[model samples]
Target: MMYKMQFPKIVLIIIITSTLAVNEIRFYPVEAIPDIKKVPEEYPTIQAAINAASPGDTIIVTHGTYNENLLVNKSISIIGENPATTIIDGGQRGNAINVVSSGVVISGFTIQNGTGGLPYSGISVSGCNFVVINNTVLRENYYGLQLTNSNNSQIFNNVIMNNMYAGIYIHDRCSNNAFFENTIKNNIVGVWSSNSPSNVFYHNNFINNTNQLQAFPPMILDNGSEGNYWSDCIGSDIDLDGVGDAPFAGDRYPLMGMFVNFTLRYGSQIYFLSIICNSTISNFHFDRSNGKISFDVLGSKDTVGFCRMASPLTIIKNYTVYINDKVPIYIGNWTVSNYIYGYFLYLHESEPQRVTVMLDLPKNENPQSLFPILVATLLIVTALTIIILIKRKGKLDKNLS
Candidate 1:
């Protein structure tokens, strides 16, 4: 005797509805939102639009000069028309732009003439989790990119030249920041850090600066087989691996010449990797899910080739690199950490070869509704159990007969 239990139809509907509701709670990234506010057309000034705009809004500033200091205290993007034509003059007053809140992006603006005293910079990032990319910080009175107590930030693809103190400065308490593909040249100090650790820097061109790198306490510069290219690195590549034979002070894999290429794609937008001082790259691909890349090209002899890609993963401690579909080898290359935006991977190549890359969606993107799946799985299992029970009961009745 097998008996079937009756279930309420309303209960099943409620369960399905609740599962759908839970899945409907979606948190979109900044790139997913499509609301864009134009400058001068929608609002008179960048700050004015910021004041009127809400979070997750984008402000596009057209080609022009804005003679004013900017203060960004909200989570938004301020994109300029072009880094060369679009300019933000500080009027020789204070920092050109001061970011006080996280989730802020300041891109494609030439920030100049931030004059005051020591510690003032063309772009001062005091908030955590911000992006300062594709901008020119030139002739600032103090630092070009200043990170004071800010953590989880990214400074990329910016020409930080002719600053008084340093091109890039990371003071105390600022950890887990990343600097890549920047041309830090002609400054008194190319890159300086004081009592700050866990900061990842690579693929940058430290060229023509008075002092290349000045860390109060000596710090490691390479993430494994990849590092920045310094114009003053006296080491040579004897084995033709494109990596320096001897350590360049703190950098282990210092390049003989400047050359690097990297790109990042999230959602539908594709961002070309920022180029540092002077170098060229051939081809590249990255597997964001596995933190690996398929490196296909290194420059021929006398040239150093590098290709890299970044993903939404924040902690990229190591990479398993593959060359021409060979066996994958694990490399503990500390590319970048908590890199405000995502994880970045780099590889050094020597010869030109056809490169192929496979990138996958992030692990957490459009997560499936677990509740529904789980309930469906349970229903199947329960039905199987009921069938087995019914068959067994029928056999028992036949035996009894």
Candidate 2:
């Protein structure tokens, strides 16, 4: 016999579950801020309204220019009416908007003319996981936008142009950030990374920049960059397919050549040698397709009895090699060394020594010559003399007994 459930108890449980679900889906509207305390109709500044806002409130900026450097240090959303009309100028001294607190969203405003020395930026989000979307950052004194040690941030649909350094720089422990659909142009570098990793970059257009993207110290393993349009790509499609026939080499850290040239005196020499050696041994290539750039690296060694060089070596085929790419290719060992001293020649001469080398044997050590027979006879006579001396000594001792 099954026990029957009470009808009132079942009805009470259903009512409680419905109420809990409704509470879980709560919506806070922009009007909620005005309800807590009525904002003055004619406030002098937007910062005053932000200071008066409570947690989870929205501060809507009217369609006008607010020449003030605002700081939002609370969990709130500051939405501007129009990105073009609503301008937030920093008087060229501090950040236009600094989001210090978490869960802040700054959308639909043009943040411009943020002036400071090197570290200051147009829109700086420090220690905050914020959404910076649909904004324009122009003529920043330093970086256009900078995220420091922040995680899970989204920077999308922003037009960042003419910045002094990188358009967007995510540096020093920033992780899991997403930069998508932004037009980053006319900056020193479109995007730069010092120690940041595990970030996703997609559908972004980098045009007319000195350098497109840069990553320092190189991404070793489990870290990669892909699926972004670069204007400087020059590979071809022989198959008429949209994708490139080959992938680009050194996509992630391709700026090493530029870095070396700027910093060292003889950096070009090193780069030329490196390219020749890598091309011969590694078969690396740089590919661009659908505006996305990436590197295609070849597999490990397959040749037996031949030890692979620690670094790559230059191998020229078909055409005569030139020293035009003027880089040194140093060949050596840990204890002793020899250099490949001459430049590559395109001579048509039929000199066999130019291609190979043969060793000459010493006359005393030649096994197939008459010197070996004479040496063997001398050794046999010397062995007989020693044996006879030993036998005579034994006979003399026996006679004396």
In model 1, what is the error at residue 154, expressed in angstroms?
Answer: 1.2
Q: In model 1, which runs have C-alpha deviations exceeding 4 angstroms?
A: 1-34, 130-139, 262-401
Task: Write down the lDDT that model 1 would get.
Answer: 0.67
Top-TM-score candidate index: 1
Q: Kindly give the number of clashing pairs for every candidate.
A: 2, 9
Report lDDT per candidate: 0.67, 0.53
TM-score of 2: 0.50
Q: Give one digit per residue, the lDDT tens place, for model 1 in 358-401.
A: 43335554345456677666665665666677668778888999
CA RMSD (A), model 1: 10.2
lDDT of 2 by residue, 1-401 (tens): 01113433544555555455334556876565322222235456778888888878777777777888888888877777778887788877777778788887777788777776546777887876655555654555477888888878877777888888888877887777887657688999888887877666654556678987787643221123233445676554343212234444344311110000011112122212111111112222221111111112122333111111111122111112112232223222221122121112122222211211111112233344555445555555554554566558657776888
> Which pairs of residues collide in model 2?
247-285, 247-286, 247-287, 248-286, 248-287, 249-285, 249-286, 269-327, 277-313
